[model samples]
Target: SGTAVLTPREPGGLPHGLRAAIALRAAAAVQDEELMAHYRARLEACPGGVSFATFAVPGTMPEDTRLAAILRHADLLTVEPRGATRDDIEGLKAADVTEPDIVRLAELCAFLAYQARLLMGLRLLRNA
Candidate 1:
C-alpha cells in the first residue's frame, strides 16, 4: 500500500527517482536503518537515481533550483512540519512546481510520517 506512494500509477511531475530520494531523506531523518535500506534499494532501482544520491544525506543540498526547493520542503516536512508555512508552498511555486505536484509532495511527506510512527510502534510492541 505504501509502495504505491513512491511508485504511483500516475506520478505526475514527481518521477519515481525523485520520490525515492525524498523517501530516503525522510527515512534518514528518523535514523531508521531498515527504512533507509528499503528506500535506498528503491532509489537504486530507479533511473537516474544515482544523481539523487546527495539528497539521501541529511545536510546536503542540491544545486538545481527546483530540486533545492523540493529538498527544503522535504527537510522541513521531516524535521519540523509544524514550522511549515505558506512561504514554503510559495517557494515551491516560485520554483515552478505545479499545484498538483505540491499536493503530491505533501502526500509523500505525510505518508512518511505515518510510516515512521507505525514502524516505531511495531518495534516497541515486538520488544515488549
Candidate 2:
C-alpha cells in the first residue's frame, strides 16, 4: 500500500511548495495558529518557496498567476463555500489551472476545513 496518494500530511498529487502554501493559507484563513505555525515552518523550509508575505500580504506577491488562482480558490472554498459557483471555477480555468489540479485543490481545501472542525470539536469535547 505504498501508493503515496494525496493526504492531509502528504503532498502527493501537487507540488510540495504549493501544498504547503495552500495548507498554510487555509490555516491562516481560519486563524488556526497551531496549523499556521506547522505549515509555515514546512513551507519556509522549502527551497526557493514563496514567503508568507506572498500569501498573507495584499498586493505584495510577485506575478504568480498559478499561486493566485490556488489561493483565491482556497479562500473561496474555505471562507465562503456557499458563495462559490461555476464562475469561481471558471476563474481558475482562465488562469490555466487544470481540472485534475482543481480537484486536488478542492480535496486539500476540504480536508483543511475538516481538520479544523475536528480539532475544534476535540477541544470542546475535552472541555466538556
Candidate 3:
C-alpha cells in the first residue's frame, strides 16, 4: 500500500488538503509524474482550490515560519539528514508546530524520499 499521509493524525493541526498539496510539491521536485498529477488534482479540487504552482519554486513560498520550517526540514531530511540538529526541531517548535506534528511531517518527507529513490531505481533498471 502507498504511504497515505494525505490524512494527518491531527486533522485540525494540519488539514488534509494542505498536506496533499505539500506532498504533491515534493513529488514534483523528485519528478514523480504520476504522484504529482494525483495530488495536483486533489489540490485543484480542494474546497477553495490551493495554488501549487509555487510549490515547484521554494523561493516563492509565502513568508510563513511554519511553512519555512517544513520546507527546511524536508530539504534537510532528504538531502543531508546527518546534518540535522536540535535547532532544526526547535525551529519547527518556534513556528508553533506540535512535537507530534513535526514527527508526522518528517515521516511524510521520508516516505517521499523513499518514493523518489524507488522511481529513480526503476528508471535506471529500465534503461539498463
lDDT of 3 by residue, 82-104 (tens): 88899999988998888877887
Give each model a TM-score: 0.94, 0.78, 0.76
Q: What total of clashing residue pairs does each candidate reach? A: 0, 0, 0
Give residue 128's lDDT in candidate 3 (0 to 100).
100
List the candidate 1 regions with Cα displacement exceeding 4 Å. Answer: none
For model 1, name the residue pairs that clash.
Answer: none
Query: lDDT for every model?
Result: 0.90, 0.71, 0.70
* Model 2 residue-pair collision total: 0
Which regions of candidate 3 are displaced past 4 Å?
A: 1-3, 8-12, 48-56
Candidate 2 minimal-lDDT segment of 10 residues = 1-10
lDDT by residue (tens digit), candidate 1, 76-99? 998999999999999999999999
Best by TM-score: 1
User: Which tens-of-lDDT digit does each residue in 1-128 have in candidate 2?
Assistant: 11122233455336756666767777788888887897777778865446443674322344778668777778888888788899988998898888888888887777778888898899899999
Top lDDT: which candidate number?
1
Model 2's C-alpha root-mean-square deviation from the true structure amounts to: 3.8
